[model samples]
Target: MVDRPRKPSALATTPGLPPQPQVAFSADNSSVTATLPTGESVSVLLYGATVVSWKDKKGEEKLWLSEAARLDGSRPVRGGIPLVFPVFGTAPDHAQTKALPQHGFARSSRWEFLGKSTSESTPTPTTPAFAATATSAAGAVAAAAADMSVKLDFGLSSSGLSEDARAKWPYAFNAIYSVTLNTDSLTTNLVVTNDDDKSWECQVLMHTYLRVDDITTTTISGLQNATYTDKTTSPISSSTQSSPLLTISSETDRVYTPAGDSPASVPIVVSSDNKPKFTILRDNLSNVVVWNPWVEKAQGMADFEPKDGYKQMLCVEPGAVGTWQVLEPGDAFEGAQTIVLGGKTE
Candidate 1:
């Protein structure tokens, strides 16, 4: 997969590398401080808009988004990025599902960084990189002289809602959430707009949790035949599968559906068995979620790690799961996902 070339400002250009650091925010902007070119330095916090912590490059705390519920205790507050929607897990008034907690509150609520632009002209380089393309329909498109990509836009206001999201599901919808990072890939675009006129049936997901090293020597390569649904027992078990390149071994959740448009390139290869370097690439997302909890739900979780952190990490995610996407009124729906880190290019 050897491509490499587009580096004009992937937030400070990085050809032979070594510049990187220039994603500031926080002057009451709430937080978003990337600075990686290996100097590592992520810091995304927006008070419940979620992503409360992400310290690496010698700081530690890789990933884990909330733990401490050995069935009912509490500590919640683990990693970054966690925004499932309308309803992601559990619902049937289990006491209003503990009054709306446990993965629904938009990763904790509070996200507003709608500012950043570049590109009105300038685009003509392509062979390995340097594209641009993003006229209007959102905005911003730059690439070259060091690399730069913008499409930033986020919303869900009322000072970022939370009265348990207006008493569990009251509608008045508006969610943009668009992001684009360069130097290979990081694209994310989610548009959910329904200004309440009628029709609204949510069930969306984006629980992206990636930070690997082991996960028992990772290997995810696009779902071969795709057609799953096995959210852990009880009247839920569809088939027409194809994903047995095995190696997981325990508590694994599943949900896939993609057999058209020839879209499939999931690759998750981690191989820390000594030498295989790193690999990530999740192009446009076609759906591939393979989880692990092992040990009877890791003994009920309180931060999960027993079993040697379940061999480290692995969570393929790019979703729609359990079906529920019905927007009317003002109607709007968009989805795109991509993440392409380095290593592996034979």
Candidate 2:
């Protein structure tokens, strides 16, 4: 027997690149986790394409998730960034969305994870010409590549909706949600496309729950002169934000809209003791919703655990809830918000 002829295996002939250290998927593919070279990471659940956790490079969690939040596909996740779409809250009496539930179906429907890609902050070409560069230059290029950020995409369409949801809002539509994890920031963008023949009206909101050491010590800025709809009242009264920084002391629920011709791209900052904690900047989102169940409301909700959980979290949501953004047939609307983590604390 000729034992001298062992063929080279495929693995031996072609070596495979190591697995990406920046992106990972759950065992059941129900979630994804993306990490940066700098040690920061973001985890997203496919249930609602909701961001479950976002941590700084030092492993400090920034997003708040309720302890009683349902993650078994039973109900929409209560915290983190649960998306609200097609309708803001309590479907208006309008004919289009009169029969829908509060906050629409985006957060309750299961989304398909569309995989991920990465973008280098400072792209370094690895072409043959660049490969021939000096060792020092090559080292610098490798260093820049290490700063690449990971972006995870999720998709949901009318065809993918449950029969109950599809029957309620019988319109052909598609939505894509992207979450990008950077070293010091997390950016989430949503693009909704109307595939129906007729136009439709809808609203979008990014319900972001930011974790804080103490709600009493936290204050939200950048809405001083903005007009807000106080949803805490029965009739939903309107008022102008008098103070430069607003502190939460009650069951707060308000939708802050741009005042007059104020730019819609202003940065909403959350701070404690005058030190910035999180800075939220939005694009194409003109309204911001600040919410907290406080003591009474918190104890009333079943999903809100610890009863006093409201004292450690604040919902600084960036949204377009003031008015409906009408989308024509075959058209698309995109809105995004970037949350930059503030300076690292001791």
Candidate 3:
């Protein structure tokens, strides 16, 4: 009898590409770890392709995880960098009134592991081509990337999604999420290709939660000359803040946008006692969300796990979340951010 062959699935192994010694699959075969030769490393879960953790050469965790975060694929894990796509906050318009559970569904969906690479090539995105716009910045990431970094790619397509999720989203598209880890930094790139026949509008964000020593004493800068929407206020106040640093105290939830009145690269710095300063930089992504559940809000959260867990975590998310974008059929959107530890800590 002749053996029949299996058609290619998204996660199928690429021919001639063997696993690298620096990369390892989890014991239970759940997650993958990519470690740099210099000892910096990152681990990503297939579910949501969420970056679960990043450790420096010293083996200190830079990203935060909830004391109560469920890692068994039950729900969106509460920490790390969650990929938020299709929409950012609540449905922004009438077409998406059906969007429930806030922040859209991309974070809860599973992604296909496209495998790891030192480098990979992809057709440049036509929609929201940010690299062209970032030319003015002399040292932008597009200039070049170091060859020593570890790269991993994950994919998700409407064809592989559940009918229930498709019925709501209904847009035919393919997304590739690339994660790069170097000795000093980690970069996450989301490239989405629109496979539909018509145009559609959507929002994307990298909701990154950074672990700090203390939320109360942490100082955040690079957003001083920016405009922010105070989501914690009853009326949702909008104003420009000129101060260089915004300190967190109470239940803080603020969305800040570069006040340049045009698209511009922004850098956000989060620093606290005994914690290495983190510098988050991104272009094309315009808005930054700063949040800490605080005491009362932390106690009320069902997923926070540790009732007082808010004290150790602060979220400083960077993405194109403040404005909606349109993607023409066959086009794509690319946005990336890099976080690096800099300077001495207390």
Top candidate (TM-score) = 2
lDDT of 3 by residue, 1-346 (tens): 7655875656874443333328888997668899864567899988888999999878999999987887778898899888888777786454852454567667878888888877422213352333553543322222222225688989999887777778888889999999999767889999989999998878889989898887878889778779889999988999887888788879888888876655347567787863448988886788888889899988887888688878888898888877778899998899988887874221
TM-score of each: 0.29, 0.88, 0.82
Best by lDDT: 2
* Superior by lDDT: candidate 2 or candidate 3: 2
Candidate 2 structure lDDT: 0.86
In order, the Cα lDDT scores of the candidates are 0.55, 0.86, 0.79
Candidate 1: tens digits of C-alpha lDDT, residues 1-346: 8666884644654343224345787776666655443333444555433444444445554444444312111223443445566666766653323345555666566666665443222334442333333442112222232354334456675336867577776677777675554443445567778887677666556666666676677656445576778778788888855664435677888877656674435554444454433354444445656676766886676566453555566665665544567788888766655554445442
RMSD of each: 20.0, 5.2, 9.8
The TM-score of candidate 3 is 0.82
Q: What is the lDDT of candidate 1?
A: 0.55
Q: RMSD (Cα, Å) of candidate 1?
A: 20.0
In candidate 2, stretches whose alpha carbon ends up further than 4 angstroms from where it belongs are 1-21, 123-142, 260-262, 343-346
Count of clashes, each model: 14, 0, 0
